[model samples]
Target: MKEKWESYPSSIRLLAIAAIIFSTGMACIWPLVTIYIHDYLGKPLTVAGFLLLLNQGAFLIGSVAGGMLFDRWGKMRTIILSSAGIIAMSTSLGFTDDFTLYTIFFLLNGLFYGTLSPVINALAVVLWPEGGRKGLNMIYVAQNAGVAAGSALGGVLASVSFAWTFFGNAITQVIVLVLFAVMLPRYVKSLALKPQSPEMPAQEAGKAEMLLSQPAPAKKVVWGALLMLCAGLLISWIVYVQWTTVLSAYMQSLGISLRQYSFLWTINGGLILFGQPLIAWVISRFARTLKAQMLLGSYVFVLSMLILSQTTSYTGFVAAMFVMTLGEMLVWPAVPAVAAEYTPEGQEGFIQGLVSGTGSAGRMLGPLLGAFIFQTFQAEGLLYIMAGLALLSVLFFALHSSFQKGSHRVPVQTAEKL
Candidate 1:
């Protein structure tokens, strides 16, 4: 276990730390923003929902722009520019009571925030080409840790004064900027200028050999797979967002307390931190191929939704959540790593950005769709819908098939294979 943690390069390790800190600050506002805007500010839920959509919409644009900048200029330059812009914008909009000002601030913040996230993921690709899945999984763990930390703290501060939540977000973003400023030239810049090695861990050596043995498929085939994967990822996230939006009302309808509902996320985050390394190791040991790992996760995701559709007891919900967390941990990291693998080397930042953009697309749409379903038909209805969507996602992933050895590999005489 210790060795597994130690396997990632220092760049990825620092990137994970940066992700945790960034997510911590983000969580400070994300989980509470709707409640504060709707309940405290006396806006309708619809208004709150639209604002959330606007933020994500802006974020999607930022993600695309950021990725292009990363590829064209360089990672360090793009990261510094994006981070500094976000900091400056957020600071200027400090502690505003005006709803219009708040809305604009959120839109701008989302754009800059969107840019930063993909760049960070791109950095992971640059730092650990061989350990793609492990690098992303570690970053995912750090992000969840930040979520757990910030959620708990945000609740406390929001109760005292809402201003503190924004203050917390701004201050932490400043710290992120500082870290990047200090570390970029020495770490990220050096990695970028040096050529990347295609080495794999011993356990994955056979699969790597097989990939090299085969004839490279057409570039069109590689791109088609990535596009489909992006669509599948978007669908998965739409269902995932239910846990934040409509799930609260679902729990309350079942006579579950808010505290109990919150505890489910606590369990979700705790399990990821402790269980992710072992899960990553298992994937490396057995799954090896990205397709197999994603298939395993997609099936688990379907199972989780099916469980949610029927369970009335608290224990059943907890069990379902555990399964759901496992599914996400398996699927999310694998997607980006595979995207990196399929990407045509120099365009990695753009590819990862496209992946992040799809995620933002889901976040933008999920809440609106989820809220409508929840209010119209309630928990059972919503769960059923989610289960069906997840099933489709599973099918979407099955389209291109596995990255297994033997037939999966093209003959090396033809060209290099993924």
Candidate 2:
């Protein structure tokens, strides 16, 4: 196992570690935010909700800016600066007693986290180009693991004191900051000067062949595909986030306990971690191309929502969650991986940022949209609408993939590569 672990590239290993640490800290804070503001700080629930929305808005802006910086300001410098801000903001939150100061610190933390996310993803692509989607997938898995760990840890700490939870978030970030400062610069240097081996899979080689054989894609064609990808991600998240936002209330109305709803996420996190190898096999065998993976995932999402619309039993909800988790496993990472493929020479970071920012847009919109629908039409109407939006997302992905059909005039093997 040790030898197997070392066989992977150093950059991949380090990035995975950083993702787990950063996400764990993030999980610690986010799940407790509304509770802290309402119960401890004496704010209304609506104010807390609004603050969360603003925090997400800040993150959306930071994602775009971070991507541009990654392209122009240099990856190492951008990463270090973002990490510093994250550490400082989180640490400030630990000591903050005033609601206004806490809100400002919270927004800054979101901004820094948003900045950090895309940079890490872009770095995964650049540092391990040969690894293809595997690098991105690894980071995704690490993040889910962090969420599981941090949520459990945060809950325990919050039971003791909210201050401890804040401190815990800062402590994890401090470790991440130290790791970035000490180890990441070497990889950044290597990125500039190193000429590494091409350890890509045969499928990736074929994809490379297809790209090389074609004339440089017209800017319009490239943008068409990229914008479609962004649109797909945005719609997909808008529907997907319903599980977190509105579904909990829907389930409770049917008499499902809060613990049971929480357990659904526990199942999600568990499957994402332990079900990776099986999921990878399914992807390799059935969905060889990124397009296929995404479409299949989108269809699965539709199925989940359809089932959810009728599901009143806890067992039924559990089944739907299981299916939903499988779908997201395919869809989420593939978005960034696909975006990486269409990236221009110097705009890799920005493309990734664009993707992340678009997803943030979806997250920001999802709850409000779902709530409006639910208020007017109730649970069944909202679920069906979510399903329809998911299908629309599938359309965007299919249209995006269509633009690349010209480039994919290669042999079957080449077409199979993503």
Candidate 3:
């Protein structure tokens, strides 16, 4: 274990840290961008909504592309190129004034951002073949920490000047880009010489070698479950994404300042930092039956959204966000972890990419759904739609659990063969 942890090259470590910083800056823009478009760009909320959707759509494309590239070109190169792309896109956005042009840049930004998951995961596994889960979780903590910081900072910067927020993000991206370019090569080279751990049996090693020798077949069951999980996750995220998108407008409509709005994100981040470890520990204790935890978390998420919809004051809103984030802390990490578990050996990159791509698709759909509902009926209507979706997700998950239970059987014959 000591050797496994120590095997990670300093370059990979530096790159991971840089990635976290870049992600933090990227996240900072989410909550503020809606207001920036409405007040500064003179665009309609629907147009802003479309721009947000476009960003995630671009990310979906990028993720698919990134996964394929990672499999072929290697992980370090992908990270370097992606980070550079983000830097260029973000910097260009600062200079552009046209709403259409800004939307285009945002799409490019999403594409670059999409490269992160596969590359990061691949690097983690390569660096610590025996400690994939622990390493990945650590990386996740870093990533989420950056996100929380970015969300909070974006709100504060938006209050001072929206331009400053964009510019600051651009600068942070550039620094990370430079840092990654210098550091990644060194890390990759250093880690390349480490021997594969003894934990991998010769047969499993042969299987991996065989996989690398030929193209992978797409598994139907895996794909089907992925689709279903994506649908459920999309509805769940729409509820959360609202906090950064429509919810900001809704809160402002109720007379909340941007500063107060930003602070809520800080609270959300703090809660995640504190709550995620506990949630992870709890999940570990019941790792054999994650479906139940998933269902419970989804139900809690629904209740929290319902509570959020009823809030008339800032305090009430904050309280509701707390409850909602608690559910989120429980659900978010589990989704990816479960995806990783179900992924076939030697197809980690493809499966992780699919998971991220599906997530991007959900993100694209969430805001559009939220904005349309908000526009048609009211914010209350938006919450109702989310609540209904969440409840439906709960039902689907429950049915899925039952189906798995009924189908599950001890494969005595297969066990004997093994």
Candidate 4:
């Protein structure tokens, strides 16, 4: 197994590494951008909140569209085009001052950025067709590591200048684009000789082609899972998004400085980086059942939020985040793997889009939800809401499992009847 991984083409490996670096830069800018809007640009908190929500909304649309495009046009082309779009968007962001213009530009950015998640996952699967669960975990580790680095660096850089942060992200995108262009040809060629699946008959092939050429179906198990996941994800994100919103206010209430605010995010990212890979390894060894993992993880996640509600000190807050990260490490990777398993063959891109779109929905709702709760009843209310949602998710997941088992047993029972 090790030899097989070691023998993966240099070009593919390079692309994966470049993808990680590019994502790192992208992730780093998010917290900084919010800070810039609120602190540097003199925008109202509500406006900043709207901008954040808009970005995720655009991403949701883009994720679904990008998935369809990837299925039709192929993963390499989709990635290249999306990267070019991101480069333009990120660079232009540094130059804009108008809140409206920035909002529009970020919307565009989200549109293109949405393509990255599904394309990267699909590519990883293609690269390690035999690796299955193990391959997915590796991809998750790579993704989270990039995110961890980006969030940590972005927080520190925001303290410097938001423009510098944007510029830094643009530079990474350019590097990734150039590397992809140079190496993609060899990567494609290396994979081309893998035996193709048996072709359909000419008439059937035409029909299959026509079906793919049309818009994707709305109904799919992946879509169902996406919706189910979104309910839980939104609750968690509502809490997490506070780090960009009222958490600063909460810290101020506690006599903490802006530097301390940045440090909190940096700490969050650091813990995620250190914890995710280890969690992945542990999950691979012990939690062979994704359903069980998600159930237990969700329970732990809710407990962390409940802990957050009672935290009066920075240390206590950080400890809550640490517990949350443990749950996240188990849940995040398992989500994609479970979604992929539920997806029908030939619809990888579509299923992945659903996954991304669901996540986007959570992100879109997170800030607003956080803001609303904080305004209405303060930080403690936010945790109560999250805990309630998490409990609801546990119920939903249980029902989903029962449904799945019933569906599977029906055919066996019918066979016995026959």
Candidate 5:
């Protein structure tokens, strides 16, 4: 772990830290949105639901818009503007009491929040072009850490006053905004002055570098590959989110306590934070290619679904959760890393935005779909159907791989370490 941390450039490390801080702030709002709307504002559950939908939809639009702006407006400027927007909206939310005004601020907050992710991802890829999945993986870990931290902190803050949660969120973002202003401008200037080479020698190249060594695919082909990759990602997220939605209710129906169900997430977060070294070692040794690692993850997802279908005991559910977490670790980071590899020279932010937006869309759709299936067919049926959905994602990935024409194998000795 120390070796990997040291291997990353200072820029990549800063980006990961920024992700942690930024995500921590955002995470504080997500868990409380429904409760705040329904309980405090005297709104109906359906109204809360509709507002959540609007927030997500706005975020999706913001993601794409942010990407376009990144390509046009420059990276540092785009990031600062996005951060400013988040700060403004979140600060307004802290003081606003009217539900109508609160809803407007929430949607704007989602919009500005959406812009940050793609730019950060595109920045990571550019900052550490030779790091393969490691750079993005580091960001992923940091975001999860932020989520865990923010969730716990938010719970405590809400106990005192709900206003505190928004204030706390805004405070974190303000720190991030300052950090970006002070630390990131130099990095972005360096990027402008020192453009990345599109190709590298095979003897020292990693997956990202090796892909860069190939002839740049035409714009249309790049979009096609991205679409295929996004299709798989969309399905993968849909299958993965069941653990929080239908699967949660199903476990409680089976007499598992809510505390135990919640503990499963605790286990999930703990393992992700602590288990990376071993997972990194395994990947470095065996699944060296991005495609291979993601395929392995997809299989693991299938295994998790199968395990869920047959299990009623708490122990069985725990085992399934473990498997599911492992699967996500492989697939989630790899998708964007792979997309980074194929991104056109001027379109990095746009490509990453599409990937982020697609995942957002899946997240928005997953609960509704999962709930419908669980209601219509029950637990076992939902499991089998989701397993099939996971399998379908595999086919999408395979199709994506096929789209990479003229690809060739490079020697193992040439590859960079994970």
Candidate 6:
């Protein structure tokens, strides 16, 4: 196992480690924000939602900027700069008992952290160009492992004082920054000016052949499919973002403590961590197509939200979360992997930026929309809204799937033309 692990590229491991550390710190704060704003600061739920919208809006811009930076500045600089920014934000947040300061720093944190996310993902693709969707899943699992760690810690610390969560986030990110500064530059320098391996030519050639062989109609179909997938992904993100927003408030209203609320996120992270590899195995063995796996997962999302609407207890919430986790395990990584399949040469990071941006847009919308429904219509209304979003996502994904089927069929003459 050690030998096999060592055989993987250094960049792959570094990116995975960065993902874990970054996401761990991020998870510590996100769930705490809504609770902190409403419970501790005595702000309205709408205020919390607006704050998150600010954060996510900044995040959206950062994601797009980060992709351009990843392409221009390269991995080492991108990682270091973003890491330093996060340290600054986290340090400020630790001492920020004031609402205005917290909101500003929080928004800055999202922007910086958004810059960080794409760099990690882009580096993964660069390092493992041939590993396909499976490689993305492995990185996704690493991130979820961090989420599990952070969520569990956040729950325990929030029980004591929410300040601890902020402090802890800073500490973890600082450690990550130190590791990157010490290790990454040298690793990158070692990779510099190296010639491509002989086998890579054949692999790249095969990829070109695959792309060239696709019928024009198929290419157009795939482009349409990508647009539809992005739409569905945005809808799904709106629902998923609620786990940290309105859902937290709703669950707590039923007598669930802060710790329990945090634990639910922990459960989500654990399932994603342990479940992704298993889901990948099943998809490879059975689903046979990325779209098929995605569609199947979307249906599960619909069911999870429906179940969530009727939940009246912690136990019921847990059950709903489990179902939601299953859907996430299936869908989350697949989106990027699907986007990767459509990416052209010299534009890898940019395409991924679009994918990340769509998700952020949905997340930006989620808190505001969720808070409105939660505050105006109450808990029952929020559930209905959740279900409706899930169904909308399903419709979009189904359209993508329909187009994908058209792409799969090739004329005999077209095959011969290749």
Q: How many residue pairs clash in each candidate?
A: 5, 0, 1, 1, 0, 0
Off by over 4 Å in 5: 195-216, 406-418
Name the 10 consecutive residues with the lowest summed lDDT in model 6.
409-418
Task: Please identify model 4 stretches exceeding 4 Å from their true place.
Answer: 1-12, 151-162, 182-192, 196-226, 276-286, 402-418
Q: Please report the TM-score between candidate 5 and the true structure.
A: 0.90
Error of 6 at 155 (Å): 5.4
Q: Worst 10-residue stretch by lDDT in candidate 2?
A: 409-418
* Candidate 4 per-residue lDDT over residues 1-418, each given as its tens digit: 4574466555446645776787788887875666688887898867777777778888888888887776677666887788888888888888888877788778898888887657766555555555455566566656666777777778677678787778778788888777767765556566665433465578876875665566534444345555666555555555555656666688789987778666766665676656655665766776668877777777877888788788878787777777777777766666666666555444567667766777788777766777788899887887788777777766655545433331110001111000
lDDT by residue (1-418, candidate 6, tens digit) is 4674576677777767877887788889876788899999899977887788788888888888887776666656777778888889988988878888888899899999888777666656655666667677768888888877777788888888888888889888888887767766665555443444556678797885686676455367667877898899998988888887788877777889988986787788777755655676768786677777787777788788888777788898899899888888888888887777655433456657777888999988887788888889988888787888888887887787666654532222211000
lDDT of each: 0.79, 0.85, 0.69, 0.68, 0.84, 0.76
Candidate 3 minimal-lDDT segment of 10 residues: 409-418
Residue-wise C-alpha lDDT for candidate 5, range 4-119, written one tens digit per residue: 77888999888888889988898898888889998999899889878887888888888998888887777777888898898899989989889989989999999999997788
For each candidate in turn, the TM-score is 0.86, 0.90, 0.76, 0.80, 0.90, 0.79
lDDT measured at residue 351 in model 1 versus the true structure, 0 to 100: 80
- lDDT per residue for candidate 1 within 234-273, as digits (tens), equals 9889988888778877788889999999899888888888
Quote the positional error of residue 113 for candidate 3 in Å.
2.1
User: lDDT of candidate 5 vs native?
Assistant: 0.84
Candidate 2 regions exceeding 4 Å error are 1-7, 196-217, 405-418
Listing every candidate in turn, what is its Cα RMSD in Å to the true structure after a full C-alpha superposition? 5.7, 5.6, 6.5, 7.4, 5.5, 6.4
Query: Model 1, which residues run further than 4 Å from truth?
Result: 1-3, 192-219, 281-286, 373-378, 401-418
Clashing pairs in 1: 214-409, 214-410, 214-411, 215-410, 215-411
Q: What clash pairs does model 5 have?
A: none
Cα lDDT, model 3, residue 141: 64
- Candidate 6: count of backbone clashes, pairs at least 3 residues apart or interchain: 0
lDDT score, candidate 1: 0.79
Which pairs clash (backbone N, Cα, C closer than 3 Å) in model 2? Answer: none
